[model samples]
Target: MNRSAAPLVRELQPGEIGPAAAGLVLDALAARRDPVIGVATGSSPSPLYAALSASGADFSRAAWFALDEYVGLPAGHPQSYAEVLRREIIEPLGLDPQAVHLPDPHREDLQKACDEYERSIAAAGGIDLQILGIGRNGHLAFNEPGGALDSRTRVEILTEDTRRANQRFFDSLDSVPTRCLTQGLGTILDAGQLLLIARGQDKAEALRAALRGPVSPECPASVLQLHGRLTVLADPAAASLL
Candidate 1:
């Protein structure tokens, strides 16, 4: 264990997600002239992204990276993580799409691409801030529980729970991707700071486990207890159990 304390849980009032997130972004930008940020997919971080997008934040010099991407989806697919990010965050912020890094699992040379992406992140001076969301099964990004906590960016078969939760992205539940490419625990730890965001009642148990449970792969987000600077942000529903 890294000897760091558990994440500081706080209850967010209605509509406070935006200001809270904007404050974090402002803090990051002020701390680093060109911050390297890691972004996650799904509905949890949407409010935060929206707030940052409208903050008039100048990201021209900043570099952005995603936590994961579906393996079989085309880059242009509406459900693709890349597309979701572009539609919700990158485009709205007027960021150079070229500067935004997304894992291209569609490539046959996925291993090579993963290595290259890691190299690019390292070369850009590692991440100053990494935003995150917890899955129903306590997964972070696509680093699902039962998998090795020390793992790195690579392909993974999505768990059934994950698929069910994300089924809306597809025409039918069957259309949801079975696999993904996600940054490893090592990659997430390389960041100087990390922010894990959550909301809703569905996240309560997972949030409680992450806060009170042991550091085990059974609850992957528990790994944050080892990081030096990790901030867990959650709304009242998500904070209920905590």
Candidate 2:
């Protein structure tokens, strides 16, 4: 593990990922009141969601926000971040959906909506823990590498690698929108703590570079290495080079 250059690089044994994330959540809850947390979408967090569901913790006081959303996808879409979260965490936990907020996918005034989203986040108090899933291209959230780190909540053109990775979620690549709205690195970093979760060989190289490589927009997650409390959790294959 490249401990010297990155945050803590934790190689967790199989079947341990969910508990780890839940533990982190509990830790955060113990650390502060009504903690603000950032969530990520997709399969990587399924275990985390399950673990959380089993925790029996009271989160009525917690505030939730997510990392990104696909532009043009209806909020009602099964694949939409909002619905995915509602299925995985909200309804099951009986969380107050009104307290949980995510970027709206169907907004006609996208940038303004993002601006308001950012404002709401800031007003609710900055995020306490921001969970993330990296892109095959080293992008964090949807802030594709090579994009400005100082960016805020805004629209982004989905990169080819990102589109390919998400193709399975859609009927076909042609159906995927070319644009998305994601919380930028700067916006994400505002969170007091961050957790980047990676698993499987598909993310091995990207994981290695994020921990050992240079800090650059060329590898957006690399910037997390600069944060005081960023944590990278992965299985052995994802931790191949450290």
Candidate 3:
């Protein structure tokens, strides 16, 4: 994907991104039965999920996959991606809990678990649409800067920047896990479409780098430039730099 030619950007008002994103997924569902969707955690996509739930969209037939999960956190932890999705997405949207999937950060054989996850995505016919949020450092999922762009689903050490950014979710900075299991860039690129959402001025610089900067590993999200179809929805503050 050419950096200049890929990723169609849309700058919308504060409350517009959520409904816009929901409409895109609903449209996809209309075109295909049981569409597989990739979900993300964080403030950026929270409104999107809420809008989806409020729209009375039928998610009973859809398959859900999370972008990543923190390692070492016990099951049912409030901060765990699985539990977060369950509370914020699945239950609200009335999605079949059985069809929702997330990486097992606690699996003994983590490599095997990652392999199985990749296989499961393939078995589900790949993700029809993927929702994503860019870290302050421009990481996608847990594919931190300086990591291989072609990486697959696997464990990764959280960068200091990432850990600090996520500290708000924990009791303290030290309480934040140093590692996580994330779908790699290669995995994310497999999605039929990528929908990246952002809000607030804090995200402006990162958003600018991700959407207008060079396609280098230092800015992992820049790899989205290689995607066949990409859509970015951002509030005025987040799109300010652009």
Candidate closest to the true structure, highest lDDT: 3
Best by TM-score: 3
Q: lDDT value for candidate 3?
A: 0.89
The lDDT ranking, best first, is 3, 1, 2
Candidate 3 residues 93-171, lDDT tens each? 9877889999888889988888889999999999999999999899998899988888899999999999999999999
Error of 1 at 139 (Å): 0.2
Regions more than 4 Å wrong, model 1: none
lDDT of 2 by residue, 1-242 (tens): 12233487689975898899889987887788778888898777777878888999898888999898888776588877788889998987789999888877677799988999999999988999988887778988898878886789999998888888998989999887788888988898788988888888889888877778887789988877778887777988788877
lDDT tens per residue, model 1, 129-200:
999899988998898888888888888788999999999778998899998889988788778888888888
Is 1 or 3 the stronger prediction by lDDT? 3
RMSD of 3: 1.2
Segments in model 3 whose C-alpha atoms lie over 4 Å from true places: 1-4
The CA lDDT at 170 in model 2 is 91
Q: For each candidate, what TM-score against the reference?
A: 0.96, 0.95, 0.97
- Give all candidate RMSDs, comma-separated: 1.2, 2.4, 1.2
The per-residue C-alpha lDDT of model 2 at residue 131 equals: 86
Measured with C-alpha atoms, the lDDT of residue 200 in candidate 3 is: 90
